[model samples]
Target: MDLKGKTIAILATNGFEQSELEVPRDRLKQAGATVHVISPTAGEIKGWDKKDWGRPVTVDKTLDQVSSSDYDALVLPGGQINPDLLRLEPRALSFIKEVFNAKKVVAAVCHAPWLLIETGIAKGRKMTSYKSIKTDVINAGAAWEDSAVVVDQGIITSRNPGDLEAFSAKIIEEVKEGRHVQRNAA
Candidate 1:
């Protein structure tokens, strides 16, 4: 029930879904893990609430300052803009790929699976995402489902903010179980 010595990284830039990022970060920390808000920028990143921009969350480190090996897990909080913007960054895709290859737990919510798609890790996993991007997920070869949370190997995904509790709980559970084996690796 505790993550006393774990370190988790929440990767995002501006336009993340507010609750999707905050809820898990706070919950993970309260469970005794050290969580860092890593972004493409150093300073603060603003989030997107339902209809407009939300408050800013401070960045603990920039993408260039950290490595995937230092983390036990990586989280990607989704908002339409956040994942779209991140998809355009080569470094972000590379970082995600590194994390996956290292077999660390990677949790994404809402539209965040867009990242897993970009990294090619979604090709054979069972996953879920905000309904709007269900096709994109399927196109990426993921076995998409409509569940609140879907985990295949080390990747954990949820539909939207409405699934936060389950999503966070699944992450905590998976992290505690430690890294996964790449069952279908080529």
Candidate 2:
């Protein structure tokens, strides 16, 4: 999918899965979209490697400085700490809600869907996330699936880092479509 001229916002804090954020960010940039990393703080956010923490990524903007209308899509990368921190930030949660309310595409991987649950936007949506989160997703009113990638409405979710290939592909597709496909009447 071609994303030329599109802007994607990644909302995260410390402990984001290194590859989850890096891989998709690089891929999105390669697809011709501008990627911005935003968080509640102004400096850099640390990433979590498989066994240990990884390097820090510079934050492009603070949650207070971002508006859902400023970007075409939103991405939330998961690491235990990343989404945990994000869920507690009122501004961050509010920003996420704005994205959903605007009907913009939202792509979340692994534990990141925790933030989606916190935003209360998963009601009646189908999605997938890290295995450990299946119960949480279901409790939030979402139908949890075990697929490599699941797309419901404009929301795209993946199981884990192993699912990045499918996750990345779905993000590109959703961004290219620029709007969610309405469910057909059963």
Candidate 3:
């Protein structure tokens, strides 16, 4: 799908999975979409590598500075701490709700779906996330699956970084299609 003029907001903070954020961000930009990295802070956010923390990514905007009208989609990258922190941030959770309420595309990978659950946006949605979050997803009213990628009602979710390829593709596809309804298709 072509995303020539689309703008995607990526919400993340310290401890986000490095590849989960970077790979999709690069792929989306290559597809002609502008990607903005928004966080709780305005400077930079650190990343979590395989066994240790990694470099920080420059932040484009703070959570307080973001608005659903400023972007076409929202992306939440997961790591142990990333989504955990986001789920507790009122502003961050509210931003996610705004995206869902606006019917805009929202894509999340791995533990990132935790934020979706916290935002109360996972109800009746089918999704996939890190194996450890199976119960969490189910408890949040979403059908949990073990797929590489799942797209339901404009919400895109993946199991982990390993599914980044499929995850990224589905996000672009949904954004281009502009229409999605919850289904167990994936």
Candidates in order have lDDT scores of 0.93, 0.89, 0.89
Question: What clash pairs does model 3 have?
Answer: none
Highest lDDT model number: 1
* Tens digits of per-residue lDDT for model 3, 1-186: 389989999999999999999999999999999999999889999999979999899999998887889989999999989999888889998888888887889999999999988887788888899999999999999999889999788899999888899899998998998744443222
**Compared with the true structure, what per-residue lDDT tens digits does model 1 show for residues 69-158?**
899999999999999999999998888888888888999999999999988889988999999999999999999999999999879999
**Candidate 3 residue spans exceeding 4 A from truth:** 179-186
Candidate order by lDDT, decreasing, is: 1, 3, 2
Q: TM per model?
A: 0.97, 0.95, 0.94
Predicted structure 2: clash tally: 0
- Each candidate's clash count: 0, 0, 0
The TM-score-based order of candidates, best leading, equals: 1, 2, 3
Pairs with backbone N, CA or C atoms under 3 Å apart (clashes), candidate 2: none
The sequence of per-residue lDDT tens digits that candidate 2 reaches over residues 144-163 is 99899999988999999998
